[model samples]
Target: MAIKFKSLPRKNPQDLVAPEKFYASAVGDGEVTMDSLAEMISYQCTVTEADCYAVLISLEKNIVSELAQGRIVKLGRLGNFQIGISSDGMITPEEVNASSITKTRINFRPGKKLRLLLNDLSFKKVG
Candidate 1:
């Protein structure tokens, strides 16, 4: 299976007079819902569908709890997730503090195995 992409007109940030260029943007095929994911996992082992669903629910809860505590959650080959922030810069080094933070975001760094899967990616352009 190959990924699908569509062309989108994008403007150059550096060149004010440059013509808009078309860039390839990925198009998602579909989503695998949690229920569907649990069903798929149930088929792989002795676990029941209900059990798989419960585990996924618990995993989500734990991941959120850990992230709230400012801890990085590393899922082995699945890579690590941590909280990242954007803040307003202060003039003095000591002037910066929590109030400087504008927003927080979850950051994911893909592991080697996960990135390796991308090597086989093929694109199909959307009409």
Candidate 2:
């Protein structure tokens, strides 16, 4: 299936007076719920839907636990999940500490399999 996208007009940040340009923006079709994912996985494997769901829940909990310990969680073909932080700048190196941290975010770097999937995607322009 092709990914759907629509043209969106956006003004240049550097030259606002210039004519706006249209860019392709991906439109989401819909969301797949956890239950739907479990069912799909069950169909593809020998596991039951309940077992798949239980494993998915455990995976979620364990990923959180591992990340909380300041370690990167690597899921083979899926990729790696790590904590990233943005911080306020300090004049002196010695002055910089935990208090300088402004925000923390989870970062996901897709693995080779996902990257290959992106390369193979077909896009369709929508209204």
Candidate 3:
């Protein structure tokens, strides 16, 4: 299926009044729940829905734990998940410390398989 997108006007940073151009933004139709995901996985493999659901739950928990410990978690061909931080820069390297960190966010770098899959995706315009 084609990914749907909508046209959105973005204001220029220099000139706030005039819009730079209309950009294509994704419009999500709806969310697919965990149950749906499990069912879909079960249909394509020998694994049952219950087993898939359990694996998914365990995967989520382990990923979170690893990220919390400032470790990168790689899920085989899926991708690598890591904790990225935004921090205030210091003039001297010695002055910088953990306290300088302002925010921490989860970063996902898609693996080759995922990138390949995205290359075959089609797009559709939405209202």
Candidate 4:
């Protein structure tokens, strides 16, 4: 008699999810487009490539301090937006200084549905 073993299933690297398709299909009776993103990116009265890069950079920075320097506005999903740090206690001198020194710290938070869609990392078999 020979011993037998069962091999685990192999995952195909080619099988990947389409973010654009997922975003479009799940926009809840709406469409997704480069224009839409461009509109969102133009929240600060401008839509240059530099502005876009600035926004992304601010998002990953010291958020608390960034807002204190001035208004840290971010364009969000569905044409919505968010302003950082309204109340006190969440602020420190360093944060304040950081905020003041940094220019245009934009932070965009995806909508609940968009977040859900992004969070969905389910894998499927290819072909």
Candidate 5:
């Protein structure tokens, strides 16, 4: 008996939805878990559970660590990710001079490669 092969459907780059969409939808409706997202991706991509987790884990670790530290960690050129400070106090220029403003937060600036990859909506093949 001969094995028959079936081609997968062609997916347009634009058709790729951001994970944020699902996150927003989940948040708007109810809570969703990491397992749920992993399952979803695995099902859609025909990937293994481990693969899904690996990808998610890497992303989570990088994002969290970048946000936690004071250094700007850029993800190869997607965009600039930074810690924003919202101050609602009256501090005159004189006061600014009096005390040194300390940064207890971290910011990230993505490199040009990351930005280009993101803007292109595609991941580059790394050797």
Candidate 6:
């Protein structure tokens, strides 16, 4: 199977006066929910679907807990999850504090397995 994409018109950020160019944007087919994932995992292993789901839930909770503690969570061969923040600039270092933070988000860095998968992916253009 190939990843599907569609051409989208986008203007150049550096030159607003420039004509818009078409770029390939990925089109998602669908999403796999936690329940579906657990069922699929159960089929691949000896564990029951309920047990797989419970473990997945616990994994989600623990990942969040670790990030809350200002630590990176690493899932072997999966990737790393880290907390990222954007803050208002202050003239002096002393002026900066938690209140300066304007945004917080979780960042994911794919591991080698994902990277390799990316290297081998084929794309199909769709209308």
Best by lDDT: 6
Model 1, 1-127: lDDT tens digits are: 8899999999899996899999999998999988998999999999999999999999999999999999999989889999999999899989999999999999999999889999988888887
Q: Give a tens-digit lDDT track for model 5, residues 35-90.
A: 88888889888798788988888987887787767445555546556665533344
Sorted on lDDT, highest at the top, how do the candidates line up?
Answer: 6, 2, 1, 3, 5, 4
Task: Summarize candidate 6's per-residue lDDT along 1-127 as a digit string, tens digits.
Answer: 9999999999999999999999999999899999999999999999999999999999999999999999999998899999999999999999999999999999999999898999899999999
Residue 75, candidate 2: Cα error in Å is 0.7
Give all candidates' CA lDDT scores: 0.94, 0.97, 0.91, 0.49, 0.57, 0.97
Of candidate 3, the 10-residue stretch with the lowest lDDT total is 11-20
Off by over 4 Å in 3: 13-20
Cα lDDT over the full model 4: 0.49
What's model 3's lDDT at 26?
A: 90
TM-score order, best first, reads 1, 6, 3, 2, 5, 4
Regions of candidate 6 where Cα sits further than 4 Å from its true position: 13-17
- List candidate 5 stretches off by more than 4 Å: 1-27, 70-81, 88-91, 97-127
Give the per-residue lDDT digits (tens) of candidate 4, residues 26-71: 1123465554555577775656756676665665465545555665
Q: Please give each candidate's TM-score.
A: 0.90, 0.83, 0.84, 0.24, 0.42, 0.86
Best candidate according to TM-score: 1
RMSD of 5: 15.7
Segments in model 4 whose C-alpha atoms lie over 4 Å from true places: 1-46, 64-111, 115-123
